[model samples]
Target chain A: MTSLYAFVAGPLAWAAFLFFFGGLCYRLLSMLRQVRQSEPFIFSYMSLRYSLRSILHWLIPFFAMGWRRNPILTGVTFIFHISLIAAPVFIVSHVVLWDEAWNLSWWTLPDAVVDVMTLVVVAACLFFALRRVLRPEVRFVSDASDYLLLVLTAAPFVTGFLAYHQWPAGPWMTIAHMVSGELLLALIPFTRLRHMLSGWLTRAYIGSEFGAVRHARDW
Target chain B: MNERHKEPSEIMDDGVEAALSRLTPEKIQAVINSVLKGETGARFKAYMDTCIHCGLCSEACQFFLSRDRDPHYSPVGKVKQTVWPMVKNKGRVDTDFIRRAVRIAHTECNLCKRCVAFCPFGIDIAYLMTVVRRIIHKLGATPLYLQDTAHSHASTMNQMWVKEDEWIDTLQWQEDEARAEIPSLRIPLDKEGAEIMYSVIAPEPKFQAQLIYQAAAIMHVAGVDWTMPSDIGWDNSDMAMFTGDYEIMGRIKRTHFEAATRLRVKKIVMGECGHAFRSVYDTGNRWLGWAQPPVPIVHAIAFYYDLLKTGKLRIARKYSHPVTLHDPCNVVRGGGLHEKARYVVHQLCDNLIEMHPNREHNYCCGAGGGVINCGPPYKNARVAGNRVKAEQLFDAKSRGAHTLIAPCHNCHSGLHDIVHHHGIDLEIKFFSDIIYECMEKPDGSE
Candidate 1:
C-alpha cells in the first residue's frame, strides 16, 4: 500500500504535471513562432481592441455566437468545463491534498458544491457521448478515440465520487481515481483537449482579423 | 434548359472532365507533397491540430444545409475528404483521390468564410481549401473553363479575352448610348491624374454592356472626376486568384494597380463586382507582398454609400416596390460593407425587406469564388447545392420583395439563376439598377 501510494502520489504525479504543463508551453510557443515566420499581416487597424473584446465575449458562454445557434450543446459544454475546473482546483479534499503535497492550498468549495459539480461533470460527459452517438454530422467526424476520450474524462470524476462515498471497492476506486486523473492531465496536450488551452488565442485571432480589417462585428 | 436546372450527376462539364483526364498518380502525389511541405505554414498546422471535429461548422454552410445536411459538404468534411488523406499518407494519395479533392476544393466549396465565423476554433477553412486549390493548380488539374479564364487573364489582361480595340469600342458604344440620356456624359478614356479610375469585370463588356451605360450615367450625373483606361490593365477581375494561379493573379493585380498609379488617380472605384474587389483589396495584393493595395480601391457598395451620404447623388424618388438586398459574400462578408450597403439601400428604396440571414451571416450566392467561372457544367449543382439561398430568396419574395437587389456582378449572375431555376417570379437588380432608376439627374444634364 505504501509503495502504491508513493508511486501514484510522488513519481507519477511529477511526470504527469511536467508533461502536461511542459508540453502545453512547447505547443503554444511553437505555434506562435511558426505564425510569426509566416508573416501574415493581420489586416486590421483596431486589431487589439477586437481581439480583447472577442476573448471576453466568448469567455462568457451566453454571450458567444455559438450559444444562440446551439443552446443545449453550449450549456452542456459550459457545465462540463466549469465542473471540470472546480472539482479539481477548488474542492476541499483536493485543496487539503495539494497543501499536504506541495504546501499549496487555496479557498475551497463546500463538499456539497463539489458533489453537485461532479454530478454535473458526469452528466455533461454523457451528453457529449450521446451527441456523438446521435448527430449524423457528429458521427461522421467522430471515431473511437472521441468516445474513448469522453469515457476517460468521466472516469476520474466517477471514481472520485465513488471513493468519496466509500462505495463498494472503495480502496481500489481511490487508486483508480488518482491514476485516471493523472492520465487525463498527461493527455491534455496530445488530444483534442488542447482546445482548452488554445481556444482563447483562436477566438482572438479570428475576431481581430475580421473585426479590425473587415470592420464587421464578428462576435 | 438552363444549366442550373440540370441534375447534379450530369453536371460535371467537359472542362472539368478534360482536367480530370490529365491527372496521373505520380503527378498528383508530387504536387500534393510539394504544396504540403513547402507552402503550408504555421496557420495551416494550427488549424489542422485545433479542429475538434465537433461538426458545429456544418450548420453554417449553405451547401451542407441545402444538401440535407450531407457531411461531405461541411467545411471540416471538405478538409477531411481532400487534405486529410494527403497529410496522413504524406502525399501518396492516388489520382482518384486527387480528382475528388479538386472537385471538393474548386466546385464544392465557395470559400465564403461563414464557416470561419461559426467554427469554435475560428478555423479558416476557406484558407485550407485555397491551399488545396494551389496544389491542384500546380498539378494542372484545374477545371478547363476556369483555367482558360486565368489563361485569358495571363495573355490578354482580361478574363473574357476581349481585344484591346474591342474593349475601347465597347466603351465608345456604351458612351454613345449614355449620351441619349445625358449628351454631355463621356466615358473618359486614358484621362491621367483623374480622381478615380473606374474598373469592371470582363463579363460587363461581353455580356452586359448596358451596366457600363448605367455607370456612365451615374458618374456624369454625380459629376465625379473619373476615367476608364483604354489600356490592357482596365479589367480588375482575376479568376486566377480563385483558380490558385498565383503568378497570373499577381500579374493582374500589378497591372491594375500600375494603371491607377500611372494615371496618379487618388483611388480606383470598381464597378459592381465582389470577387474583383476581393482580388484588389485582399488576396491578390497580399500575394504581391503588399499588405494594402498600392492605390486604394473601393467597391461600388461603399462608393454608392459615400455618394449618397455626401449628397453627391440625390434620390429623385425612391423605388416604391418592396425590394430585398442579397449581400454578396465578398463585398458584405469579406469586405465589411454590409452597413454601408444597407444605408444606400434605405436611401434609394422606399421599402426594403431584409433577407433571413443578412450581413456577415449571409449565405453565399453560389456564384463567387470562381464557381460560376467553372461554367455551364458545374452550374446546375452549384445552384442546386445552394437550395438554402433559393429558400432565403423565396422567403423574401413571400414577404413582397418584388425585386431582389444583388450589388455585386457575380451575385447578380448567381442570384438571377436561383430566381430563374426556382421559378421565383422576382426581378434581379444591382444597386446601380435601383439608383439609376431612383437618383435625380442634374436638371441641365437631363
Candidate 2:
C-alpha cells in the first residue's frame, strides 16, 4: 500500500503536473496562433479595462444576473470552487509536500476548515450530479461524459476526506485520492474543465465587444 | 416536467421545406464541413470548449421563460439542438434534423446577446446560432420571406426592392408632406458635403413614409444640415445579415457607407431601427474588415440625445401621458443607448414609467434579428413565444403606463403585434412620433 501511495505521490504526480501545465500552455498558445491567423481583428478589440471589469463582476458571488437568478446553484458553485482550490492547495499535507519538494510554502488553512471545505466540494459535486440527472435544461445538454466528469471531480475529494478521517480503508483511500486527483488535473485541458483556462479569455472578448464597442456591460 | 415536454410548433416554411426536398446527405455534410472548417476559427472552438452547460442562460431567454421554462428553448438548448449535433456528427445530420435546426436558429431564437450578458463565461450563443444560420444559408434553406429580402438586397441594394426612382420619389413625397406643415422644409437629396446624411430602412419608403416626414421636420426644426440620398444606398437595413448571406450583407453595407463617403458627410445619422444600426455599426462593418464604421454612424437614439443635450432641439411641451419605454436589444444592449433613451423620454414626456428589468436587461420585442421579417407564417409562434414580454407590458400598463414609447422601428412593429395579440391596450409611438408632436417647430406647429 505504501509503495502504491509512493508511486502515485511521486512519478504520477510529476506526470499529472507536466500534462496539466504543459497541455494548458499548448492549448492557449495554439488558440492564440489560430486567432492571429483567422480573426486577428479580435486583438484590436481586446481591452484590459473591460476585461478586468467583466471578470471582477462575474467573480463576485451573486454579482452577475445569472448568479443572482440561480441562488441555490450559485451558492453551490461558489462553495465548490472556493473549496476546490483552497482545500487542495492549503491543506497541511499538500503544503508540506510542496515545501519538501521545492522549499516553498504559503499560509495554510486550518485543517478543520479544510475538512469542511472538502466535504462541501463532495456535496456540491453530488448536487451537480443530481442536477444533471434531474433538471430538464441541464439534462438536455449533459451526456455520459458529463456524469463521468462529475464522478471524477468528486472522487478525489471523497477519497481524501475518508483518508483524512482514517476510515476503514485508510491506506487504500489515500492511494485512490492521489490517483484520482492526479487524473483530474491531467484531464482538465482536454475536457470541459478547460473552461478554467479559456473562460477568462472568452469573458475578455465579450467584455471588450460589449464595453469598448457596444458601450454596454457584459455582466 | 409536463410543461417542459410540450412539442415545438412545426411551422411550415416553404423555403426550408423545399430546400430539404433537394438536400442529400452528402450536400448537408459538405456545407456543414465547409463552414465549420473554413469560416470558423479560434472563437468557435473556444466557445464550444468553454461552455459547461449549467443552463444559467435559460432564464435570460424569453423563449425559455415564456414557454414555461422549457429546456429546448434555452440558449444552450437551442445550440445543442442545432450546432452541437452538426459538430458531433461531423455534418452528417439527416434532413429532418436540418429542418429542426432551421426552425430553432431562424424562428425560435432572437440572437439577442442577453444570454451573453448572463453567462458566467460569457459564451456567445448568438454567434453559435449565426453559425447554424450560415450553414443553413449555404444549404439554401433560409426561410422563404427572409431569403426574398436578401434577394432584394442583392438586386436593389435595399431590402424592400424600392426602385431608384421610387426612393427619390418617396423622399420628395415626404418633403411635400412636411412642406405642408413648414413651407420651407426640404428633404434635401444628393447634396454634397452635407454635415449629416440621414438614412432609413427600406420600409420607410415602402410603407412608413410618415416616419420620413417626421424626421424631415425634426431636422428642419433643429436647423441641422442633413441630406437623404436618392440612390441605391438610401436603405440602411440589411436582411442579408440575418440570412447568413455575408456576401450580400457586405455589399449592402458597402453601398450604404460609400454613399456617405460620396456625399462627404461628417457622419451618417440612421433612423430609429435597431437591427439596421447593428448591421451598420457592428456585424456588417466587421465583415467588411472595418472594426468601426468607415463613416461615423449614429443611431437615432444617440442623435436625439445629443440634439436634446446640446439644446438644439427644444421641447415646446412635455407629453402628458404616463409612458413606458421598450429598449430594443440592438440599440440598448448592442449600442448602450439605454440611459440616453430614458433621458430623451424624460425630456419629451411628463411621466416616464419604466418597465421592470429595463435598460440593457430588457426583454427583446421578438422582432429584431430578422425574426419579424420571417413574416406571417411564423408570426403566431413568434407572438406566442414571447408571452413573458406580454406579461411585462401588462405589468407596466397596470402601473398606470398607458403608452409604450419604442424608439426602434422593429420594436414598434413587434411590440404592436405583441400588444394586439396579448390584448394589452397600450398605444405605441416612436420617439420621433412624439417629438414631431411635442417639439417646437419653425412654423409654430405644436
Candidate 3:
C-alpha cells in the first residue's frame, strides 16, 4: 500500500508536472511564432489598453459578460472550477502531503471549507455530465471523450473526499486519488483541458486584434 | 419539403450543378491539404484543440435559432460536419460531402463573427469557415451566382460588371442631377490632391444611381474636397473577397489604394456598404500585406458622424417617425462603429425606438458575407434562416416603429426582403436615405 502511494505521489507526480509544463511551453511558443507571420503591426496604442482591460474583465467567471444569461450553468461551473483549483492547492490534507514530500507548505484552507469544496466539485461534475446527457444540443456535440474528461476531473476529488473522511478502504482510496490527480495533470496539455493556457491566448488575440487593427471596442 | 433539409443541388442552377459534377475527389483533397498544411498555423491548432463542443455557440447563431434550435446548424457543428472530416481524412472526402460543405460554408453561415463574442474562448469561427471557403474555391466548387460575381471582379474589376464608360457616364448623370439642386455642385472626376476620394459599390451605378445623386448633394452641402475616380477603382465592393478568391481580392484593393495614392487623397470615404468596408479595412488589406488600409478609409457612418459633429451638415428638420435602426453586422459588429452610428441616427431621426439587442449584439441581416450574392437560388433559405431577425423587427414595429433604418447596403436589401417576405409592414431606409430627407439643402451658396 505504501509503495502504491509512493509511486503515485513521487515519480508519477514529477512525470506529470514535466509533461504538463513542457508541453504547455512548446504549444504556446509555437503559437507565438505563427503570430510573427501575421501582417505588420498597425501599432494602435489603444490595443494594449483594451487587451489588458478585457483580460481583467473576463478573469472572474461571474464578471464575464454573459454570466447572467446562464446563471445555473455559470454557478455550477464557477463552484466547480474554483473548488477544483482551491481544494487541490490549499486544502489542509493536500498541504500536509506536499510538506511531507518536499518540505514545502503554505497557508491551508480550513478542514470544513475543503470538505464542502470537495462535495461541490463532485456535485458540479455530475451536473455537467447529466447536462450533456439531457440537453439535446449539448448531447449532440458531446462525444465519449467529453464524459471521460468529466469523470477524470471528478475522480480525484471524490476519492480524496472519501479518504479524508476515513471511509471504508481508506488507504486504497488515497492511492487511487493520487493516481487520478496525476492522470489529470498529464492530460492537461493534450486534451481540451489545454483551454487553461490557450483560452487566455485566444481571448487576448480577439480583443487586441479588434482594438488595434479595427480600432473598435469589443465591449 | 422543409426548407432546412432541401438538398444543395435542388437549388443550384445547371451551370453550378455541372461544376459540381466536374469536381474529382483528388482535386478536392489537394486543395484541402494545401490550406490545412500551408495557410493555417498554430492559431488554428489552438482553436481546434480548445473547443469543448459545449454548444454555447449554437445559442448565438441565428441559423440554429431560427430553425427551432437545430444542433446541425451550430457554428461548431458546421465545422465538425464540413471541415473536421476533411482534416481527419486528409481531404479524402467524396463529392457529396463537398457539395454539403459548400452549402453550409458558403450559403448558410454569414461569417459574421457574432459567435466569437458569445464564445468563452472567443474562437473566431468565421476564420475557420473562411479557410473552408478558400479550399472549396480552389477546387472550383463555388456556387454559380457568387462565382459569376467573382469572375466579374476578375475580368472587369467590379462585382456588377459595369463597363468603364458606363461608370463614368453614371457619375456625370448624377452630377447633372445634383447641379439641378445646387447649380454649382460638381462631381469632380480624377481631381488630383483632393482631400477625399469617394468610392461606391457597382450596384450604385447599375441599379441605384439615385444613391450617387444623394451622395453628390451631401458632398456638395458639406463642401468637402472630394473626387470620384473615373477609372476602374471607383467600385470599392469586392465579392471576390467573400468568394475566397484572394488573388482577385488583392487586385481590387490594390487598385483602390493606388488610385487614392495617385490622387494624393488623405483618405477614401466609402458609401454605406458593409462588406465593401470590411474588404478594404479588414480582410482584403490583410491579404495584400497591409496591417491597415494603405490610405485611411472611413465608412459612411463615420463620415456622416464627422460631417454632423463638425457642423458641416445639419438636420434642418428631424424626420418625425417612430423609427428603429438595424445594425449592419460588418460595420456595427466588425468595425465597432455602433456608437457613432447611433449618434448619427439620433441626430437625423426623432422618436427613435431602440431595438432589442442593438449594436454589437445585433443580429445579422442575413445578406452580408456574400450570402445574398450567393443569389436567388438560396434567397428563401436565407430569409427563413433569419426568422429570429424578423421576430426582432416585429417587436420593434409593435412599439411604434414605422421605419427601420439600416445603414449598410446589404442590410438595406436583406431587411427589405425580411419585411416583404414575412409581411412585416415596417418601411426600410438607409442612413443615407434619412440623411438626404432631413439635411439642410444648399441654395447655390457656400
DockQ (C-alpha based) per candidate is: 0.56, 0.86, 0.52
Ranking by lDDT: 2, 1, 3
For candidate 3, write residues A130-149 as lDDT tens digits.
98998777887788899999
Model 1 misplacement above 4 A? A40-46, B1-13, B443-446
lDDT of 1 by residue, B11-118 (tens): 555665666688777777788888887888767877877887888898888889999998888888898888788898888877667667877888888888888878
The RMSD (Cα, Å) of candidate 2 is: 2.3
Candidate 3, A90: how far from true, in Å?
0.5
Specify the highest-TM-score model's number.
2
**Chain A TM-score, candidate 3?**
0.88
Best by DockQ: 2
Q: Quote the lDDT for B218 in model 2.
A: 93
- Quote the lDDT for B366 in model 2: 90
How would you encode candidate 2's per-residue C-alpha lDDT over B241-337 as one tens digit per residue? Answer: 9999999999999999999999999999999999999999999999999999999999999999999999999998889899999999999889999
lDDT, model 2: 0.92
Candidate 1 vs 2: which has more lDDT: 2
Write out the backbone clash pairs for model 3: none
Interface RMSD, per-candidate values to 1 decimal:
2.0, 0.7, 2.7
Q: Write the per-residue lDDT of candidate 3 for residues B82-136, one digit (tens) a residue.
A: 8779888999998888888888988889998888877777788998988888887
Winner of 1 and 3 under DockQ: 1
